[model samples]
Target chain A: MAFRLIHASDLHLGRRFANIPQPPDGNIRGRLMEARHASISRIAKVAHDRNAKHILLAGDTFDTATPSDSVVRQALTAMGENADIHWWLLPGNHDNLKDAEPLWETITRDAPANVHALADASAVELAPKIFLFPCPVAFRSSGRDLTANLMDIPATKGALRIGLAHGGVVDLPTAVLTFRPTETVAPGSIILRLATGTDVSKSAIAHIIAAAPNRIGSSMDGAVSA
Target chain B: MTLEGPGAPPTVEEVETGAFLWINTELPLLPNTDCARALEAVLPDEGRRDILIRVRATGWASLQQQADLRQAAARLGPDFAHFDFDTNMLGTTYDDADLDDIDKAGALRLAANRLKEGTESETLSAEERAVSAGALARLYAYVKEAAE
Candidate 1:
């Protein structure tokens, strides 16, 4: 038998449309707010229609870490109405662990029996053999990767492991350069530093030096030749 | 209920009711001594029941709770703005600054100041520093939100 689950994220409940310009005649802001709440029922209906018992909300369920009590209660109540569908909530950068401690605590204390808040990095069994490894965000902007340890987590044999995480993929290349102080440099002397632990080849360094020859000293040419 | 002195234990009647008391074990007290007498003496009126105890919690878990409370107080509304602090450790008043009076930017500045002071202090343990760093990152997020 195959497991079915609905993947959704960034519901952003209680989000005030402060930036959007309000129309003089219509209540667009109110309509947007109502729409956010209405999405829950729509998603639940979709889950019910598709026979997906599990609804995995990746992250950012709330607009802010400290959403109003009414917003939190209303969302939980909406999710609670659909008892058959299980809602798995993960804290994203917006509602991280450090900033949204009370929010999670409130949900844990008052959420319906079907809702599960994945606040810890643990493997939860969604079905008989399907497991979900959730990487809940601790800080709003953790410089380090949150899912670095997903591969090391132990799981059952032949189990279908699914990793759920949220964050921007940083593709910037970084390199650490160390200066080799072999000779005493003068005021106008160019210092050659070697890039360590990076994929930048020696030819790249030579190309960079060749691009700017006036700034780079003649000693680097001899060093590169050696 | 009758009381002997400031450091005396609670009577049976008081204990039968929901009289909550917390005593620091590091002080000069006997084993298993309740601090109900001290707590009762400081009660301003009959309506107040909650007593804020300021203990020097050095463990990582305790620091994390403190950090969480501070963050919640800043992000949440006025309900969570009040917090207790140890004057000896923080060199401040018995209570934390009233975050309700200040705006969001002011609250963010206060959190930043705390993170800076914690980082500069050499006495903080590794766990304490880690918690402070997490708090600092959240502070950055708060600032970013304000800017947006």
Candidate 2:
């Protein structure tokens, strides 16, 4: 069965939008913070509207492993709000599974019944003929290619397989948005990690849905394949 | 003064207390671009100054672009005595100054003063300080270039 999925990654839900130049009265920080929640809301709306059975969050759902309690609460609430959509959130480099009590753990503890935090690399059946493989980012930078194991998993008969992952690769038939929080500063020079692109301002999940059919979706320079 | 735009390079101004620059555009600070050249032309290589760059852009600059700006700033280190920029993002604005009497070089000199009160500030978190310092360096380079 051909399944529709909303693939997004690198939500960076609690990132500090620091040192940005804006009008003194403009609510850039608040707007940015709200934007994160809006991305989730948008995902829920689109998932419901598109009749998508699953929402695949490849990785980096939270900006840090130890996100504030409020952020955790808000994220879970958003997931709970969309109870009909199944959410598969994979841990990324930013929210890696190395920590004993990482953000994923907190999420799993607090998430709604519809949400599943994928901390291990594994495969599961989404529907009768739909199989899913989640490649969890175990560390910030790992020597192992997270998605390599997907090929070894024997396919179930008549199943359509989908793979989800985060990070960069040279050749992929997907559009990638890499968010580098820091840049290497040359001697006597400096650099700031400024917010740019639709990834932060708008819902890349929506962008993927709008650009679907011919496009593969990814975030933070990672790729998701159907 | 607040510089609003469809994304242009920053401009320079001298205030009564010190000098400053304002970026009112929305273009990414990509290297070898007009915005880069505009920044280069507005900053000056001169005496002690306390410059606050009020960046009001909403553009997302790529890592490569930021790295290129860093490279340019490294080339013009000695020309500047000091540098600083606002630590707040979005919702902070820079007041405009009447710089009619001041020449371009004079304005840059005043802007490129000692880098902040000190290298490290107690008000800023370590990450903020580092980010602020690097942004200041990029701003200073543009000021040096523009002021000259």
User: Of the candidates shown, which would achieve the greatest lDDT relative to the real structure?
Assistant: 1
lDDT of 2 by residue, A1-226 (tens): 2346666655677766565334565554455556565667776776677677687776777878888889878988887886788898888777888852557777778789999988876666677655567778787888766665544455344344455666544322222222111112112111111111222212111122111001111221111111
| Cα error, candidate 1, residue B44 (Å) | 67
In model 2 chain A, where is the ten-residue run with the lowest total lDDT? A208-217
lDDT of 1 by residue, A100-207 (tens): 999999988999999999999877877775677788989998888665565445434445555666543233122112111111221111121111112223321110
Worst 10 residues of 1 chain A by lDDT: A206-215
* CA shift of A196, model 2, Å: 16
Residue ranges of candidate 2 with Cα displaced over 4 Å: A22-26, A171-226, B1-148
Q: TM-score for the second chain in candidate 1?
A: 0.28
- Deviating ranges (above 4 Å) for candidate 1: A169-226, B1-148
Local error of candidate 2 at residue A215 (angstroms): 24
